[model samples]
Target: MGVQVWTWILVGITFAIYFGIAIWARAGSTKDFYVAGGGVSPLANGLATAADWMSAASFISMAGIISFSGYDGSVYLMGWTGGYVLLALLLAPYLRKFGKFTVPDFIGDRYYSNTARTVAVICALIVSFTYVAGQMRGVGIVFSQFLQVDITLGVIIGMAVVLVFAFLGGMKGITYTQVAQYCVLIFAFMVPAIFISFQMTGSPIPQIGMGGKVEDGAYLLDKLDQLHTQLGFKAYTSGSKSTWDVFAITLALMVGTAGLPHVIVRFFTVPKVKDARKSAGLALLFIAILYTTAPAIAVFSRTNLIETVSNTAYKNMPQWFRNWENTGLIAWTDKNNDGKIQYVNGAALEGKTPMFLSERGEHGQRVISNSSTGPNELYVDRDIMVLANPEIAKLPDWVIALVAAGGLAAALSTAAGLLLVISTSVSHDLIKKQLRPDISDKAELKIARISIVVAIIVAGIFGIYPPGFVAAVVALAFGLAAASFFPAIILGIFDKRMNKEGAVAGMVVGTVLMLFYMVRFKTGLVGVLDPLPESEWWFGTSPEGFGTVAMLVNVVIAVVISRVTPAPPASVQDIVENIRIPSGAGQASTH
Candidate 1:
């Protein structure tokens, strides 16, 4: 069967399932809209949360990044999964006990200040918006290939589908829909990994196969490291990033993952505080299924790509190679014009670089040249690794179609969750709490639905005309969350004396500082300033690593400011103590 036919069939089936879930799980009240009636089973909530947490980046782009970054990529693995440990132990259960419908609601009530809540809402919007744009891009990439439409139209179609499900069902619908999506995406992700593992190492399990010896008796990592060095790249088993920077990036990602409002909101859907904890554990397990296999996939794909494509002539390349090259993501320049492609470290090559060209070959391949005449002759976008993996391995057409469906599932599930956060923050935290406290439940729910539509449109715009600094901004979203929300939420829980002034100041300062660092380094927002180099870094902290510094600043400032101010009132202190005790947990309260 043709790729389009298979894609349409599989994608159509998944869409039908999602739309059915949306109709069946439609919210009947504000409680249903916001927290799915707070009666979700722990097992089910875990699946839904997994779907929400594993965005397109996790399913599609992560392994690709890992493949090229080698050991340095461990930061993503440790940081993302490690954050779940903190969520399970530090945040989820206590937040569930607090029984608020959203993260901002908890901040408002906990600190006894609308200003604190407002700050939190702004942070939530920024984080969720930045993250969702990436997911939108993922959605567009899949649909653009599957439906044969331009990326802009693909994004619009994706937005329309998400609108129907989210606007109609709210959290009630999105939760159940995510459960279905989790199953689809995980299955889609694993099949290719298992196939590649068996093909390469004769073992069905990717994890064990990764370590198992192949035909030559050398372990897979050893082979990869050997090949990597031969090609002038860093050894695959060793890291290139500095230790302090890796630690800082990992720490920032961990805290940022915990601080994200969309993931935190999942706990609010469970029946009890205990269920929230149990659900976090299950979600981690579900996520780990993919996370553990990803490194294996990365090693396999990297080895295969290097062996197959490096030094091969363009005319003799495989169809999958040619197919991807047509997408403009995979490009090669005959820099030496020897008619053989050289894929090596560009920095290490000697000579002036060949000029880049807009011309195309008869095969429709881009006429690329060396960025400089280093050993480099090719540019492969890391984002294409997973999506191109099945084809790279010469897997069946149906499996490729399934991967397309999986990408959409990963992108759509997270997009819905983030949009929910955006809409709820606007309607529940900003409008209902501040502007119209006495608004009818019906009116507030209506506004929330409208907010979802508006948020989707705004998110789509960001995706379509993304900025040059989007990559940094996306990472900075987590940094911003880590720096701002993590400290405030933690201090609010553990310290009864944490006053509103301290919390507000910490959030504001942390968010602003992180933004300043990101905009200055990544964008022209600073206006023609010379690029900051590694030598100028504060204690070797890169912009990506600065979140940890900002987080510490928030903690220290909040602590110092709280000490100088009056303590929190007795009633608020009592509520804090009550939250620490897990018993008598109730459903999420709108009031």
Candidate 2:
């Protein structure tokens, strides 16, 4: 069968499976909708959480970023994976021990203030919506490219899929669906990577192939280092970033990962605190499988890309080149009319005379076009690397189809999880707790489904009109979560003296600071901080790394303000004490 036929077949099978699971696991009560009746096994919850956390950002964009950025991209790999350590050690077990249905519930009860809870609800909504918009956009991108549908229609289809499962089954349905998604996405990601690894290094293991010797008798890392240095770029294994920026970015991601409402809420599905801790460990193992393979894929794809295009004539380029160019991902312009493509570090031209582009090389520059007078320029979008990998590696058409399915699986699983959090926060925290205390469980469940539908519509609209690149939006979401939620939750758990006033003030200040910096640096709000000139960065840290500083500001402000204010009431302190001890896990009640 043709690739399109196989793609449709795979998609049809996936849809049928997900819908069947949704019907079989339909939630009948508010508790089931909110937390899967609070009886999920650790291993199952871990698999579900892995599926929910990976998202399109991990499966699609991460390897691409690493491919282009080289060693600098390691920060993302380390930061994202390392954050789980913090989550397992400091956050998950305590939150699970607290036995709350929502993150806001813990804040409200622990602080003994409804104001604190309301603030958390608002923060959760902001972070979840911002993050979900990117996931929805990813789903649309995958559908548009592989399914041959318009982006808007793709987004609507994706929304329908999420709503069918999430609205009917809630957490109960979403959990099992995510488990299946995890299997599909992992298999899809690994197959092409393993094939490419063997083709490049005669090793079937991707992680080892990353640093292994190439077929040409050169170490892979050494060759990458040589290529980077020749192109006036940094080495592939080391970085030139400032220590403070690294520290800050790492810290921000750690806190943000722990504070993500969707991720944290997954722990609530497990029956006990011990299960939560065990589930966290399992979740990390699942995530590590992709995390370890991703760097290998990055290195392999980068090497393949550079080697394939470096000296080849534009007319003789592979079909994959034209295919990606049609997607607007790779473009070529000839300057000296030599008909060959030239790829180099654009940043190397800064502060130095453009001898290559402005003049001719010793070998005489090759220009593929008569319209330009300089050397040829190559532009490759990072987003295309992973999606185009199978074609580049000459893998089977079925593998490409599987990748498309995997991309959708990653996006849909996370979208369902985020939607559940958004719905529960609305129906349980806002409606049941604040709006209508007398609301019945049936009424709450109905409202949860309605909220899921509404959330899907909002997310779909944003998906069609995504604000920026996928990774950039994801970083912003993490920054917001780190600034607003991490401080409150950490202080609430560890410090007995942290008060509602301190937590609220810290979150507001941190969130505002992060927004201001991101707008100024990333979105061009200020003329003084334009994209040109390497000196434009604040302390040489990119906007993506600014979240770390924001997180610190939050922690410091919260601590300082807490000292100035009265401590929490004795009852609140007792609740904190109870949460710290695991023995009373069964007795800890959700509001």
Candidate 3:
């Protein structure tokens, strides 16, 4: 079958399943809408959480990053997975015992102040919206490739589909849909890895295949290292990042992962505090399946890509190369006019353009003098690696279609999860809790729906325009969460004397410092000053790793302020004690 027909059939089937799940699991009460009535089994909730947590970045882009960055990219794998351990041990069970509907709900009640809650809500909105933009962009990429539409139109279609599920079922519908998504995405991710592994290393297991000897009796890693050295790239097994930066980035990612409101809220949907802990454990296992295999897939795809394209004639370039080139992600200008593509490490050579657009001359031949320099000629968007793996390996058309469906599932599930948090924070926390405390559940639910619509529209706009800020916002979201929310939430649970004043100061200071660094160094939002480079950074920290410093600052500031201030009220202390024990902890109440 053709790519188009296969894609439509597979994607159509998945969409039908999602819509069916939405209809069958529709929410009636605000409780159902927010926490699925707190009746979900641990296993089911774990699967749903895995789907909710693994966004398009995890599914489509992670391995490609590992492929290119080599050992440096291991930061993502270690950081993301390590955070789950913290969540399961320190936060999930206690939060489930607190029995609140949202993260801000816990913050507000714990501090006995609406101001603290409002600050938390602001942080949640910032993180969730920033994260959602990436998901929407992933959705657009998948749709543009599969449906043969413009990226803008694809984003619109993705927005509409998300609206249907989020608008109809809220959390109740979203949870079940995510369960289905987990199944589809995992299947899509694994099949190609297994196939490619067997083809290359004679091992059915991808992890072993990555380290196993190939047909030439050489270890895959050894071969990759040799190839990288010959091509002027860093060794595949060695990294160039400083040790402190890696440590800082990994810690930031771990804390940020645990702190993200959308992820923490998943624990609330289960029946008991114990179940919440079990769900986190199970979710980690489900996520690990992909995490461990990603590096293997990276090795396979990187090797294949290099051997296939490097020093090959342009006329002999594979169909996948041309297909991606049409997307403007991959371009070659034949810098030497030899009609051959030279894929090299452009960063190794200063003031050299790797890829450029060649202007046509009178004879319609490529003219190098008129070429325009931008991104490297050999550039490849990391997101395309997973999506194009099956095609590049010449797998069946159905397999390619299945990969497309899986990518969409990953993006949509996480996007819907984020949109839910953004909506609930507004309707439940901001409007109902603070503004209209006496609002009816019916009215609150209406407001929630309206909030979702607005959130989706805004997310779509960010995806369509995709500013430079939007491109790096996922890192920003993680850093912001690490700085602003993680310490407060952690301290609030463990420390009875953590006053509202201290928590608020920590959050505000942490958020402000993190944003200042990102805007000045990363975003260039303030043009008055040039951003500092790595050598000039404080403690040699990159903006990506600055969150660790910000987090530590928040913790120290909070401790100092709390010591000088009066302790929390006795009732608040009692609530903290009650949550820790979890003896009589009940289901999260809608009220």
lDDT of 3 by residue, 130-224 (tens): 78988888888888887788878988999999999988899999999999999999999999999999999999999999999999999999999
Q: Candidate 1 regions off by >4 Å?
A: 347-358, 362-365, 369-373, 467-473, 526-531, 582-591
lDDT of each: 0.87, 0.83, 0.86
Residues 338-393, candidate 1, lDDT per residue (tens digit)?
77778886541222222436786554445654455556777776777888888888
Off by over 4 Å in 3: 347-376, 467-472, 526-532, 582-591
Residue 437 in candidate 3, Cα distance off native in Å:
0.6
Give each model a TM-score.
Answer: 0.94, 0.91, 0.94
Q: Residue 308, candidate 3: how far off, in angstroms?
A: 0.8
Clashing pairs in 1: 349-374, 353-373
Q: Write the residue-wise lDDT of candidate 2 on 557-584 in tens digits.
A: 9899989999889888888887887564
Per-residue lDDT value at 173 in model 3 = 96
The top-ranked prediction according to lDDT is 1
